[model samples]
Target: PLLKIANDMVVDLPTPSNISAWWNFGSLLGLCLVAQILTGLFLAMHYTSDISTAFSSVLIFLHETGSNNPIGLNSNTDKISFHSYFSYKHLVGFAVLLTALTALALFSPNLLGDPDNFTPANPLVTPAHIKP
Candidate 1:
């Protein structure tokens, strides 16, 4: 039964021609997916799924200084700021991730399927529904 399904897959059929090196985007995409999954897992370890703690946990993970306290006469005045760190890193990471995803989408339009799959979200409503 599985073999029949595999045999019937017209989309999975490969051409007799050799694929160009440019076609390696699929492999690169797989690598990116792996990286995202691993990073996501690491993030999940520190993340709080509950609405009350979710934002705070993300802030702490992204912003908390990983140890670099100033030691001097005015040491009390110096405090580690997670806001700066988190904002910068988050922005950079998001930009890179979006760029990579966009490039993949461009390279392989069939990757995500038809236009019906592309749906816009109502951010305000999504959070309300996700809240526990």
Candidate 2:
């Protein structure tokens, strides 16, 4: 299949050929950005960006992944058309995320808040070094 039916990215990868180094760089940069975006999306699926947890999560992610949180091994194989399948998936994903966040906030308003917002981060204490 041309796109593996939108399931797999095996065919989607840009194969290097007789292109110039500069052209290759453009492809490389695009690939990097796509990978970065996908990585970010996967993280956002699990992590929330609220006050109290944000600082800890940011520090932990930096320390553990060295701020390079990966999207893991290539595994989207069966392939569908990106225009039809992925575009819809993107919109649905965003909708689901927003719906979930709205529900959570409505049901548990205090869960997403930062208790220490007024205090601010202390320069003397490094959150990355603090014990949980």
Candidate 3:
């Protein structure tokens, strides 16, 4: 079945006899992009961006195949769709991400944010909110 599909898609596809070098350019770029994506997937599956371990993870190939971090390969593949831009799976995955972002913003706005951003414009004069 797979061979038949491949044959129909590639082997038996229509092509002009006078196809120029530009025609091959597109195919070459497609193959290069596919190779790059596969390599990126392999890398994402192996390493993690944990705050504490990120520095050390550089030295050792930290295997994250077992971990369920959202930045992992599974989550990346979940959003891919060749047929349509807004597929059901893609929308659901986006909704999940949006809900998590909203929850974090409502409950703990600065939980994962930089502490410096919450500071007063000028530390010498106490913040206006603290005066009242």
Candidate 4:
């Protein structure tokens, strides 16, 4: 019954005569949100929630980064583009998301970290720059 109701809602849904990049981008964002939530759930299983350990845990995770990208699936109907074109279209969306993240990390890393983290470090020497 619930499945029938769900299908009925989307049954014969009309596609707009003219679609915009922004609408495609909006769907991309929705997909990204679902990916983020699922990945967060998995990470949360091991992540330290306590304030005391959260900072250290983040640093550990950062240091351990290599294969951190969450799985993503992109699908488009014949209306959007051909397979290769659809791939590049989604690539543009991914680029936009990556650029936003890079900007945040560069401009406001402190929003997620303490003043000590914002400080530059010389990895060659002792870790005196780190706050106690």
Question: What TM-score fits each model?
Answer: 0.26, 0.25, 0.25, 0.24
The residue-by-residue lDDT of candidate 2 on 1-132, one tens digit each, is 422322234235555676544453367664564566566666776575555488998888777666322554334563333688888999999999999999998998878678776477678877886687
The prediction achieving the highest lDDT against the true structure is: 2
RMSD of 1: 24.0
Deviation from native of the Cα of residue 120 in model 2, angstroms: 19
User: What RMSD does model 3 have?
Assistant: 22.2
Please give, for residues 1-132, the per-residue lDDT of candidate 3 as tens digits.
533333334434456777533453358753554455566656766665454477767545555344545566566556655557558779899999999999999999879989898866875787667756
Candidate 3 Cα lDDT to native: 0.61
Q: Which stretches of candidate 2 lie over 4 Å from their true place?
A: 1-81, 115-132
Better of 3 and 4 by TM-score: 3
Per-residue C-alpha lDDT of model 4 across residues 35-129, encoded as one tens digit per residue: 65556656776664565488888888866763333432233232433679889999999999999999999998768777787689777977765
CA error at residue 35 for candidate 3, angstroms = 51
Better model by lDDT: candidate 1 vs candidate 4: 4
User: Could you list the CA RMSD of all candidates, in the order they appear?
Assistant: 24.0, 25.3, 22.2, 29.2
Candidate 1, run of 10 with poorest lDDT = 2-11
Q: Can you give the lDDT of residue 26 in candidate 3? A: 59
Number of clashing pairs per prediction, in order: 1, 13, 0, 0
Q: For each candidate, what is the lDDT?
A: 0.59, 0.62, 0.61, 0.61
